[model samples]
Target chain A: MEERKVILDIHNFSIAFEQYENGFKKTSLPTIRELDVTIHEGEMVAVVGSSGSGKSLLAHGILGIQPYNATLGGEIIYDGEILTEERKAALRGNEIVLVPQSVAFLDPLMKIGPQIRKGKKDKASKEKLDGIFKGFHLKEEVQDLYPFEMSGGMNRRVLVSTAMMGNPRLVIADEPTPGLHMDMVRRVMAHFREMADNGAGVLLITHDLEQALEVADRVVVFYAGTTVEDADVKDFEKEENLRHPYSKALWRALPQNGFQFIDGTQPYVKDLPEGCPFGPRCKECTAECKKRIAYREVRGGRVRCIHAV
Target chain B: MRHHLLFIGKNLIRMILLLFGVSVAAFILVSVSPIDPLQANVGQAALGSMSVEQIEKLQDYWGVGQPPLQRFLAWASDFFRGDMGISLLYRQPVLEVIKVKLANSLWLMCIAWVISGVVGFVLGIISGLKKDTWIDKLIKGYSLLIASTPAFWLALVLLMVFAVWLKVLPIGLSVPIGMEASGVTIGDKIQHAILPALTLSITGISNITLHTREKMIDIMESDYVLFARARGESTWSIVKNHGLRNVILPALTLQFGSISEIFGGSVLVEQIFSYPGLGQAAVTAGTGSDVPLLLGITVISAAIVFGGNLIANVLYGIVDPRIRRGGKRS
Candidate 1:
């Protein structure tokens, strides 16, 4: 219960970018719409989504890599303090590091040692990173080798080392174990679990539900850029408690659960349904579903489906 | 070290082919010219009185009477052995004439080379790291402006502005044109080279600026750069350590591609400043149709090109390890 203390509190966050054309008229595309999400210390939150679910955009928001042209509407508080631009740069790489998808994540031309040592002057960063590299069975000599010289496994280890070098409180991994072998996935997942145990929040984003089920304490399922389901991993296991029609449908759509594929496409943000974004594709849809966005809460979880109550 | 050597060997092969192609074209162009050096040596008065026997003998002496391949091979062999014959225009040993000029040109070129290379590379990285920001826009504007303008035109403009308007450096001549009795000392000669060297560098420096900036932008988008950022690396570290190094890959590999430009710049700069350089010496040889002098200059130019490209290749191979690993795919 003490661990539930908020590490990040993002409220009503919206981001829009202006596009210019035809000699100067500009229009905005609102990507994130009133998104409210939070993460407590030592938590593992798996962001579940299909492609283009705005998962990466959320990561960009947290890291402040969102372009200057982007108009952000919301408060992002880190440790009870409003996260400003100066804090964003300072927090990045040390306070909230990222582990992006590709194994070739380290610079192909530079050696690992100097690359890892870069921009990090703090104590916890250097020591913990050195420990992780040694713990991962990666040799110290590898610091001299270029990214291309390292094997896929070695590169994976080196990437984890570099991210941990900052000893960040939050580690956002976008499909961390994608394209990796099954053996490597377990090892990577174990590393994430160890990180969370050591007081770092691990935000692992992935489309692979089974992997998420393995390591995540809780999960937030994104549908059409909206969090349709937020619940403990156990809440996802119960057949009766799979309350959201979308969540139930998603549960049914799992290959292991005997369904081949989900029946329809996600709702377009621009041409979204008046009520639930999933209403168009939901088998339990009714005429009343067209009036408002779905919002419902089960005993131990929340879902954005009207009929779920 | 082993990989480095292997890359050097591979690069040497490529340089040899490139130089061979260039040398063949140069040989044909120089040989088929309208004015023959032997005829050039003998004025209009001697031309009418010269016997057919003497004319053939003169042609034979210059090896023009022999088959093209034979003459080229003989010339290449002797040229490599430091026997480039004599200049018909200067009436001096071709080696003796070109040596001092080549030395001076090399010195000026070397300085300009270091300056442009270092500054362009560092600026390129900075621009890429600040992509889409005002800093990036400013560098992009500067690079484009420099790249699009012609070198000689830029030279004249700079001369008028810096030398005439500001009076910082001398103009038109290299080191007191009278030729001091002891022949202008090394230090004075260098002081005289400033304007011409700067004039020679405009295009090359600009080209380096644009090219490195563009290349670094491509490198910044690379996965590794993203990876570096993900690792919590600072902007400066990413730009310097990651962006610049990878961007320099193609630059390193294709380095010899610019040697011809440098030599070409030297030719123009020499004429503009009236400084005595091997490039202008070659031009003087060509205009006067000095056969031995012409051959010597042509051969030496080819050799310098060959040598420069060779160095570029060797250095490239050292920087890029992939070339050493599989030999070709990289």
Candidate 2:
């Protein structure tokens, strides 16, 4: 088969914030360190991490919407071109869309229609919006209502409709299904899957491993602000097939796989130890694991652990 | 339709009650004041030389011999019939004097109010959008300085500079000296009003500017604004679409609330300029103990302030859809 075009290739991505310490002392906190994710045309990639692991930061960093104090260190290659700040600005809403995490992201004072349309009043745009809203089961009268006047489910659908309004080639959904019921979660996931089926690159940043496995073709596991493994979804069928120790542990902790958990929590970014971030909690940790570990390929999958074969 | 009508009716009743309360308060306070309307209006020597019958006639004419409640009742009854009584000091009908004086003050006040609101709102938006920069710092410092400065002091300074030394504008009054109402030009009225109106405008700008600046800052930092930026909206577009709507409502509320402050400030400003506006007339009535004229001015000014607030409340419904849609939150 012919190789699919790489739509988004993010390598060694890291984000650090310039913060004030005690008495005006300045410090740089590396919240995301040496993360990597790549998605091909028509592929759905999920970056799965728990809260504070900086999964959302990756999405913001890719879109160039990081906080004012954040400093980025990485090369985000999109459609074979280096994604500069200007390029991100140019392609943000037209080519690359973000389905934000919450209903609060919608402007409270604005009407639903003009906001989704980004104030576009052309006939083609309006017609496209009508079709998209119809598909989402939103009525014509709903367009005139405010976001606060709608249910959470309706607002969630409205956010999804924003991505579809424009012919977006890359859709970055950041924790789009938190606090949602399983049925609603599946519905939102299917909308994203449809986007991918239409040949767009969809990057879904989620914390639920089961949800990620349900819709994503590939999963990148984040541990302590780093991607420890990048494996195919089929690799998660058994714990032994996973390359990284953390990914194996995650698979084993799934309800169908005995719900076993490892000891110790992920280290805070400020107190991360030398070498492997999971070293202190790994039963198979050796003195060699104290050195800086590099991400390398092992049996057609990427892993950060030296012991993985 | 019924909801709107009910809202208006409720506010109208409230306005009547408010005016009544204000009139009674002004009457009681003026009655207890030691100015002695008979002595203030007529000379002290004239009072002593008057015959007993003449003295009784003067007391009765001034309503000084009647009980406070009875006098108030008499005034209220006459006021309800559109009769504001006669000004003892001006020797004219109280309503007629107020109408003429109010016309003089209205233009001065309206000019000041418009200039302050427009200029302050634009400066506030610029300062907030350029927060933490030199422009923001400069506007903040200017607003603070103006807010702290006394209106009378500013008025005096402007008068000294423009009228005393510069000799560019008229020193006082609404028109050129010795000019008849028929002969006086609009240009002459404006020139005389410039100093007093400038004083009022300069002082009024600071409150709205600072308040709008604070609100704009809050809006710029909100999550929706951030999302707008992420949606590829230019900074100007975000402000036009999001920031303006959020901040304008609060600015309007502050704008109307400033009316009373403007009316109060006009009193001192008019006194300083000697301009024959309602504020100057109010001062003259108070010092001369023209009870009828003072009471008339009190009722009118109270109505204006209350009316401003009522208009603001009504406009809130038109401007904000959340309020307009009426109490249904999902």
Candidate 3:
């Protein structure tokens, strides 16, 4: 296969929140630790993780939209350049767009048309919006309507349209299909797939592995706010192709893979074990796993487990 | 268009019912009060010197012999017909007294209202946007202090500072005491109004500033605002495009709601300032047993307050398209 350009490269990203605890003393909660994800030109990478595994925080971190109290660590490289805070601000909306998780992200008082257009009234923008609305099966009049007037499916489409409004180089869709039906979820996923096909790097942040496998080129599994595995979509077709024990567990838990689950829930961030967050739950966990495990390649896929061969 | 008209009609009917209720309550309260209108209006010496027949005539004129309900019905009917009766204290028509008094009060109240609304809203936005900072702390502290401070006490303080100590402005009244009504310049009226208007505005700011700050903080933290930032919207752009509309609607509700508070404050404020506004007339009528004048002022003030709320409701539709459509479009 030809080497496509790397559109976004994330390295050791961490997010910690400073909060007031016990009188006036402050403590930092490491919500996301040493996470990593990479996307290439015309590729969709799904970062799959359960809720509070900091999947949403990863999206916010890349966009520099993390809350004021949050402290971010690690570097995010976009288009061969370091994406600093200033660069993120400059590239956002025009080059880097975020398809937010909920309809609540839309301004309620604003009309749908102006909102989707990002308040653009130019003729070209208008024509482009019309085309987008039509492609989404939304009536032209839908633009004149408020978000509260639209169906959940239509609003989701409208949100996708916002990312399309700009020719984004990177589209980070943070759990974009929640509260949507299976059909709607597929439809929304298809929209992200189309964006990737159009040559924009699309980061599909979701928990549903089955849905992620439908459109994503690679799956980056997040465990307790850190990436444990990054493997090709084809690698997920068979459990033996997966390197990490967690990936095998995830594959086994799929409905088609016998509907099995491992013991112990994902640990809370405060109580997370020293090295591998998945150590306590992994059947193959050894004393070596107790030490810091490096994310390295094994059999053409990246794995954070020392025992993975 | 039809929906808007129906809304207006509904609010108009509501306002009328509210005014009627207010009028009846004021009439009943005044009737039950321990103050004997005969004693209050006529001096003890005059009452003792008056013949038995004269005392009965005075009682008849005051409508003291009639049932409270009967008097209210008579007053309500005459009120609807535009005959507000005569003011026993002013010795003039009740409408005429209210008209002049309302005009003066409107000027003072309107000035105070605008100042409070504009300044308070801006301060609130600044405080909320800069939450936890010294500026936010300062505004919060100021609003808290103002909120707890009595309107009458504030009015007295202002009166002493501007009128007593400085003596640059008039201490009391809407116009100069020696000046004829026709001769009183707009400048003179404004000069005299400064102290009272300041007192009312200062007192009014705390409520709007505090409420709007709460609302602005909520907007700043809202998911939409966060998303807007993610979309690369500048902080100012986010405020203009998202925060303003959300905050302004609730702020407007508080602004209009403060009309009653302003009017209530005006009563004590006018008393301290000795301003010849509706509040001062209200007190005069209340003390002097001028039933017709009191009822008229009560009804008019109630209508003004109701009218303010009606305007606010109508404005909500203009401000928010969802309300304009009567509900959510879907």
Candidate 4:
């Protein structure tokens, strides 16, 4: 395979929030630690994890829109340049776009047309938005209505249209297909795939691995706030081809793989083990597993487990 | 547009019915009181020397000799025709008495209302943006202090300081006594208005400030605001365009309730400064058992309050698209 140009490169990323525990006794709660993910030009990368895996935080961190108390560590590079706060502010909504998870993210008071156009009243912008809306099956009159005047599915379509309206080079879609029917989910995933085919780097964050594998070029599995494995879609064809123990477990849990179940839950951030976050639940636990493990490339795939063959 | 018009029409009818109910309640309450308008108008010495025929003649002149229901009906009919009846104390037409004083009170309260609203909104935004910081703490402390302190006492203290001690403002009244009513300049009205307006504004400013602060903080944390930030919108633009609309819609509803506070606060503040507004006239009517004057002021006040609320609802429809569009389908 030809080496594609890197559009977004995130390395050793960490996110911690400063919170008041009890009456001004402050503590730092580290949610994401030592995370790494990279998106290449013309590629759709899916970051798949269950709830509490901090997948959404990675999107917010990339956008520089993290909450005020959240302290971010490590570097994020966009097109070979350091993505500083200033650069993020400048490029956001133009070069990079986020399809947010909640329908509530749409301003209830604002009309759909102006919001998608970002208040641009010019003829060309309006025409372009109308085209996008038509593509999404939204009526011309829907632009005059408020978010509260629309259904949840309609609002989600509007959100997708918002990202489509902008000529963004990178699209971060955070659980964009939830509550959607199977056909609608496939349709939305096809939109992301189309964007990647047009050379935009797309990061599709979802917990549904089955759906992700249908569209994504690469799958980065997150477990307990850290990346456990980065494998191509072909690697997910069989459990043996996957590198991480957790990834193998996840693959076996799929209905096609006999629906094998893991016993323990992913530990909370406060109770996370020192080395491998999945150590407590891994069958290959040893004394060496208690020490910090670095993500290493094995068989052209990245894995965090040392004993991966 | 047609739906909005129908909604407004319905609200107007409701307001009229509310005024009728208020008139009936006010008439009953005033009629059941022990004081007699005839006795209140005539002195105690004159009452002792007067004959029964003279007393009956006095009651007839004052229009209190009729049954309460009969009197109320007559007054209501006359009110519909724009005749507010006659004041027993001032011995003048009630409408005439209220016209000038009502204008003066409206001007004073309007100024106070505008000043307090602007100041409160700015302070609220600041406190909300800097929540849990020293600036927010100071604003909270100030609002708490003002809320706890009585408006009347605050007026008196302000009166003593600004008028008597500082000698910077006029002591009492809406205008100087000898100036021609037409000749009285805006400067003169403002000079006399400063203390009373400040007195009326303190409690309202504090109330609105705290309410707006709480509302803005919640709105700033809302998902839409975070989304806007992620869209690369500047903080000021987001606050002004998005945050203020949501915050001020609820604040506007709270402001309509403050109309009653303006009237209620004006009574004491007007009496304290001898400012001749409707509140002072209402107080004088109460003390002297001037039944027609009291009832007239009550009707006018009820009309203003109802009108204020109607205006607020209309403004609410204009500000909130959800209400204007009659909510979402499914």
Candidate 5:
């Protein structure tokens, strides 16, 4: 296979929040300890994780839009250069776009059209928005209505249209299909696939493995704020093909896979065990797993477990 | 547009009912008071020399001998016919006395309101944008001091410094004594109004500044604002377009609600400065038990309050599309 040009590369990224405890004593709570993700041009990578696995924080960190208290570590390289804060600010909403998770991101007092267009009132921008809105099955008059006047599903579609408005080289969509119906979900996934086909790297952050598998070329499994596996979408076809123990457990828990659940819940950030984050939950855990484990390549896929063959 | 018209009509009916209620309440309170209008019209020395028959005739003339309910009905009927009756203290038509004073009071109130609104809102935006900084802390401290200070005391302090100590401005009254009323220039009026206007504006400024800063900070933290920032919109544009638009509604509501405080402050400020405004006349009427003048002032104050709220509601409909459409839908 030919080497695809890398569009986004995030290596060993970590996020910690500084909070004041007991009036004046400051403490740092690490949320994402070590996360690594890479996307190539013309590729759609789906990041699959359960809630509080730091999926959305990864997206915000890449965009340099994290909350003020968060302290980010490690490097994020975009294109061929290191992505600095200034570069992120300059490229945001132009070369890079984010489809936020909540519909409340829409301004309640502003009309739908102006918000999606980012206040562009030109004829070409208007017509382009109309075309995107039409593809999403939104009416022409819907653009004139405020967000409070629209349904949750309609607002989600409007948010999707905002991403399509700009010619973004990278699109980060965070749980974009939650309130949408099955058909709308499919349509949105297809739209992201189309963007990927057009040379844009699409990062679809979601909790639905079935939905991610339907459209993504690659799947990155996240467990307790760290990447446990990075494999081709076809690896999810069977438990034997997957590389990590946590990934296999996730596949088994799917409805179509006999709905088998693993024992114990994902560890909270405060009480996280040392070494491998998934050590407490892994059935194959050993004394070696109590030490820091590194991500290693196995059969062209990456896994963070010492026992993975 | 029809919906807007209906809304206005509904508010107008409410205003009329409110005025009627205020009139009845004021009349009953004044009638039940131990202070007798007959004694007010005639001095205690004069009352001591008068015979019982003479006193009864004077009471009958002033309608104080009649029952409270009868007097209220009679006043309401005359009030509806545009007659405010006679002022026992000033011995002039109550309407005539109020008309001149109302104009002066409105001028002072408007000047104070505009100055406070502009200054408070601008300071609020600055403090909100620079939150947790020393500048923000300084403004907060100043607002706290002003809020806690008494309006009358502040007025007295200003009068002593600017009028007596500095000797750069006049001490009291709207117009200088011995000058033709028509000869009073705008500059002269402003000069005389400085201390009173400042006194009236301090409390309003404190309240509005605090309210506006809180609302602005809240809006800056809203999800929509963060979304706007993600769109690479300039900070100034976002603050002007999204931040100001959302904060103004609450700020305007606060401003309208402060109209009562403004009037209350005006009464004290006007009394200290003897500015010849309605507040001073109100004080005189209350002290002398001038029933007709007091009732007239109460009705007018009620009308002003009701009108201010109505204007605020209509403006809210114009500024917020949600209310505009929701009003129609309901």
Candidate 6:
């Protein structure tokens, strides 16, 4: 909230992509709609959303590597400076890094050693390479092994080591534990926590609510390309103060045996019901939800649905 | 070493069968020619002018009196024994005549292949990574135009523009062979090999280029590339470390069929340039109906195609681990 306090601030960020039709943009939705968020220095933010909710798309824009079709609006500020094209050039890989979903960060043909070497840092910085690999529970011999040799978890951890090797300020990890076993997920979450504790801002993007709750300090919920809620992880359990019905329903659907599952569906994008995108999915839905559109900040969080008191 | 040898041997057997099939097709087609080589040679050299004993002798010598299967078997048996008989035009052993020409052809083809394949693959990768970009669209259009069009015509156009119009190079017989054409130096031969080789390579290069680009696009857009990019890898590094490896494997498969690829399309390029290669020899023998010569060229070309496929199979194990020993064990 204060000047020079936030490390990364995305204000009114939206993305529309051009398609084959020439005159119109395509995809199920615009991806991100009026999404405002911030990351303080040395803070960890977790992005949790349904598939196609544009969490990845938002990351692409923030990283300034959105697919060629992406047309982004609004300003992204990093450490009190607005991120221009030139600023993004400096920010990439050096200031911020992303550990994508498992095994995606590797080159299939190349050995693991060179992959880490391909980072943005200088030669002397490369001496720390072996040390970093050791830290990730990998053998020093793995440096020469091709991606095909290592297990899936090994590949994901290798990318994480490469990410932190440069001493980057921010790390965005998308789907860190999608298909991993419970033990492996805990291991990766521990790695994220370790990085966050070491004073690097880590944004964990995933669909797993439990995984986010395990390691994330703060959580941002996305529904239908819009930010539905932003709240502290400590307060994620409070049901009444939760603003968006979509957000509340998501919390309900967590597979707790005693937890009551909310009966609501995520709104379909193209043929969406009018007004609040979550209206059709909300158990407390009414006709008035169609007419009102605004993000209301209540006690525990900020939510997009106007029905919240 | 044993593993490699065994793999090669299996592929070689498949190659032999393919070659045998192609040879049969060539033999049948040559046999069906409307103009008889004997007739074309001597206006129905019936040996009718000879006495009864002599006519029988001539028919026997030519193997015409034998049944078709017996004749074919005899021909095959003789071929295995390295006796290709004599060429009507050259008056030399067909094998001897072809050896020199095949060498020249192989040399030219090797050079052309090296240039075209490397260039095409590189361009394909670049074009593929940046698909729909100006460079990608340009390379795609250029490759499509080059590949769909004929190589011979393109050679002639290049020859006209680069040699005749510009006076940059010579017209024909640019290199001396067997001390025949003023004994030109190796440099001169290379200079001469340049134009003809270019003609032979353009379409192959273009075809390969286009195919590689298409493959690269698939590889680049894969979930893998996104993962690599997200790791803060530079665009160039991404292209090299990840994109190139994945994209180029399928293109490697393309080169496995390089045998049929070169000979099938190179016939016209050979004819246009008057390059004394297997293709040209085949054309001459086919036109003249010189059965033995035709058979030799047909078998050789078929063998080349066969070898190419064989090479492709072995290459599979090298490029993709899924096809290799470790993969099989799993």
Best by DockQ: 3
DockQ of model 6 vs. true complex: 0.46
Of the true interface contacts, the fraction found in model 6 is: 0.51
Clashing pairs in 2: none
Off by over 4 Å in 6: A1-4, A20-29, A119-123, A257-264, A286-288, B44-62, B155-194, B312-330
The DockQ assigned to candidate 4 is: 0.61
Interface RMSD, every prediction, one decimal place: 2.2, 1.1, 1.1, 1.1, 1.2, 2.8
Better of 3 and 6 by lDDT: 3
TM-score of 6: 0.89
Q: Stretches of candidate 2 above 4 Å error?
A: A134-137, A257-291, B24-73, B326-330
Worst 10 residues of 1 chain A by lDDT: A291-300
Best by lDDT: 2
| Top-down lDDT ranking | 2, 3, 5, 4, 6, 1
Per-residue accuracy of model 6 over B158-230 as CA lDDT, tens digit each? 8898889997876755475456565678888887778888887787888889888888888887776775665
**Taking the tens digit of each residue's C-alpha lDDT, what string does model 4 give over A201-242?**
999999998899899999999999889899999999988899
List, residue by residue over B59-151, the lDDT tens digit for candidate 2. Answer: 787777679898889888999999999998898999999999999999889988988988889889989999989999999999999999999
lDDT of 2 at B254: 82
lDDT tens digits, residue span B32-69, model 1: 87766666666667867889898777766655556767
Over B91-141, each residue of candidate 4 has an lDDT whose tens digit, in order, gives: 899988888779989988898888777787778878987899999999989
Worst 10 residues of 1 chain B by lDDT: B321-330
Alpha-carbon RMSD to native, per candidate:
3.9, 2.9, 2.3, 3.3, 2.6, 3.5
Which digits, one per residue and each the tens of the lDDT, describe model 3 over residues B92-200?
A: 9999999999998999999999999999999999999999999999999999999999999988887788788988988787788887879999899889888899999
For residues A14-68, write the lDDT of model 3, one tens digit per residue. 9999988885988889999978888999999999999989999998888888888
lDDT by residue (A1-309, candidate 6, tens digit) is 333347788877888765654557444346676677777766788888888778888777878778877788887888788898666756777788877776655666666787777733566766688778777778888876777788776777786787876668888887877788999888888888887777777888899887898788788888777777888887667666566776677677777624666555565555666777777757677878887477667775677766677
User: What DockQ does predicted model 2 obtain?
Assistant: 0.62
> Could you tell me the lDDT of residue B147 within candidate 4?
85
**Highest TM-score, which number?**
3
lDDT at B145 for candidate 3? 100
Native A-B interface contacts kept, per candidate: 0.61, 0.57, 0.78, 0.63, 0.51, 0.51
TM-score of model 4 vs. true structure = 0.89
